[model samples]
Target: MADELKLLSTWFSPFGSRVKLALHLKGLSYEYVEEEDLMNKSQLLLESNPVHKKVPVLFHRGKALCESMVIVDYIEEAFADAGPPLLPSDPYERAVARFWVAFIETKLVEPWFKMLDGTRARAEMADGVKQMLAAVATLEGALAQCAKGRPFFGGDGVGYVDVALGGLLVWVRASEVLLGGVKFIDAARTPLLAAWADRLAALDAAKAALPDFGRVIKHAMMRRGAAAAALAQSN
Candidate 1:
């Protein structure tokens, strides 16, 4: 019997987007339950992820799995025979993939959040942007090493690191718009990485999994407005 699968996610969450991308890459058909308000989460979400109470929780065969990356790994393992492999078969390659995924989750994302919240002064925010760009440069180098002239990090296919970083493109693009057209990834600064991002965006799975660009921009604008208001009030 086929296992019943359900994914609890929120539309704007890049973390949740990772899980969606993994599922699509695996060609897994599952119910997507959107949580409208995270503060007032659904009972199902609460019950499914009592510890984190977070979205991107995967329920397979009546067991709940929390954390976006963890859920993605689980999907890759459980559906190993169902679709293209997310992780490379070679242990060394798999370890390298996991390393970059960890770098993306731990090193890159927090600085991005700080930049997004806009709580820092002008100099601090500039430094934050520099930090983010440095992280991108590191990723670009890693991709260049692994891509080996292929379009993706996984050599003609999207793999673990691809899903890990690809999901954040929306937010990164939105942040550029929010910052009055400050370019983060572009042909001039990050040509290879920028091209890779474009390729990822154009993929059918990405088009299906990612939220609309307009929606992301609008949400980002709202957050920027709120941040600006808060900054004004503080002065």
Candidate 2:
């Protein structure tokens, strides 16, 4: 069953990367269909994810799952007895793991949208930066507290929690260029987070699933440049 999984994702989306990492971690082979034009989204994407009309949709045996985290959860459940378990068996710890995922999406990813979309006003960008900083600081503190004695977020191994938070680090690192020369995972300010990122990147799954940061950055720059040119033409 795992052999027949199919993933629909955009190259630049951190959300998409999360599911890819999960699949790689489980040693699953599936079709990876990249969405080239977001504007003219494929019928599969719209049909698979009717609600969100978004990418990172996973198709398994003709069943579809939307939302990156939801897809990761599905992957975890599908291969639970076979691969490295994503969710801890303990219910209490599973809840904690889920909390961080929610925190990253609602608290961090949301602000990142504003920061990336150059259409945002100056004040909005400032507010977004402020919010992103606050969220990052909170995540840093929480990770430090959690890593008191161990390495990964799941004590000794990379689990759902680690994949949930750590998957975004690469994208965040790439987007540092957008933040006016501020890097997100500086060892000095975010030592634990930085180290954790290095550890995740070292993993075979993480390495395989690592997005092409350069290409994504180039795409972002092109978008920004086109937008700026349009604005200048309007003026």
lDDT of 2 by residue, 34-103 (tens): 8766667789877877876777888899999887788888888878866788888898888888888788
Which 10 residues in a row give candidate 2 its minimum summed lDDT?
226-235
> Where in model 1 is the C-alpha error above 4 Å?
1-3, 119-124, 225-235
Worst 10 residues of 1 by lDDT: 226-235
Model 2: CA > 4 A from native: 225-235
Candidate 1 lDDT over 41-66, as tens digits, reads 78988898888677778888899998
lDDT of each: 0.80, 0.75
Best by lDDT: 1
lDDT of 2: 0.75
